[model samples]
Target: MMHEILRQSLRWAILVTLITALLSILLHAASATLLRGLPLWGGMVVVLIIILVGVVFDMMGIAAAAARECPFHSMASRKIPGARHSIVIIRKADQFSSFCNDVVGDISGIVSGAAGFAVVVALVVSLDFHEGRWLLETLTIGLISALTVGSKALGKTFSIRFANEIIFRLGKLLFILENRFHIRVFNVKNKKKRKRKRGVLRAPRTD
Candidate 1:
């Protein structure tokens, strides 16, 4: 059992590493292309938007980890669209939280930093202010860092207090994505009995 767990952990680590690298490359390239011709203000706006994405994803990660699965079961009995999805999130909270907090959150942070750099460089070049370039870049990076840290700190507290509600709303969005757009985000299975189920996801564990 220990061996299996070790193997699974290693496997997941490798997979996540590859996924993160590829995603970062794609996102960085896209952001660079988008910022190429945009003005300093426009690039700064894009950077702010990316920071917002990181904050939101961090909130979802913490919320899923803190949410309870029982309440969602009750909602599911009422034929609520998002209730089932919420259960899935709570069941796989560990993985979901890691994905949101580490993968998406980290990617967004990297992209935002690159975007901030672009914005600062554009400002310096546009104003022909070479003398203050270093100082301006330092301030821009500091502001971005402050914003990301401050917002994420606040988000953590808010998400914990309203974990279930946050997960439910996110579940509703996932439900729409799956049903309307035909995306299969989760698989239904019985985590306890190792049996096939329908319309839900199960947490993996050792019995």
Candidate 2:
């Protein structure tokens, strides 16, 4: 059991690193394309959007970590659309949170910072303000940092408070995507599901 846990952890670490890098590259490339030939304000808007994405994903991560599983089971008994789906997410909440918080959230931060640099460059080019380039860079970085940090803090609090509801909403959305659009997100096999049927509200303890 210990060896298996270590193996899974190491494997996840490597995979998450690759996922983060890929997501960062894709987002940066998209940001570059978005900022190309756009006005200064437009560039700023794109940066703000990037920051918003990060905050939202961070909220989802927090919610997943804090969400209880038993509510989902109750919903399932009532034939709710997303109840079973929610259980799948709850089952893999740790991985989901890591994917959201560490992979997408961190990538958003890095890309947004890069986007801020692009914005500063754009401002300098548009205004020809070479004298104030340092000030501009500092202010731009500061503003981005503030917005990202502040919004994430608020999201964390809100998510913790409403984790179950947020997760149920997510499950509903996932159900819609899968059933209506035929997009399978979680391929939850029935492996040992009965054995784990009476699982606790939290994730099952390995030790």
For all candidates, the clash counts are: 0, 0
Candidate 1's C-alpha runs over 4 A off are: 189-207
Please write out the lDDT profile of model 1 over residues 1-207, one tens digit for every residue.
999989988988898899899999998998898899787777888898899999999999999999989998889989798898899999888888988899989999989988998898899988999999999989999999999999999999999999999999999988899989988788644358676778898789989
TM-score of model 1 vs. true structure: 0.89
Candidate 1 residue 116 Cα shift, in angstroms, is 0.8
**Candidate 2 lDDT over residue span 1-207, tens digit each:** 999999999999999999888888899999999999789899999999999999999999889889999878778888899888888988888899999999999999999999999999988988999999999999999999999999999999999999999999999999999999998889744466445456558867897
Clashing pairs in 2: none
Q: Report, for every candidate in turn, its global Cα lDDT versus the true structure.
A: 0.91, 0.91
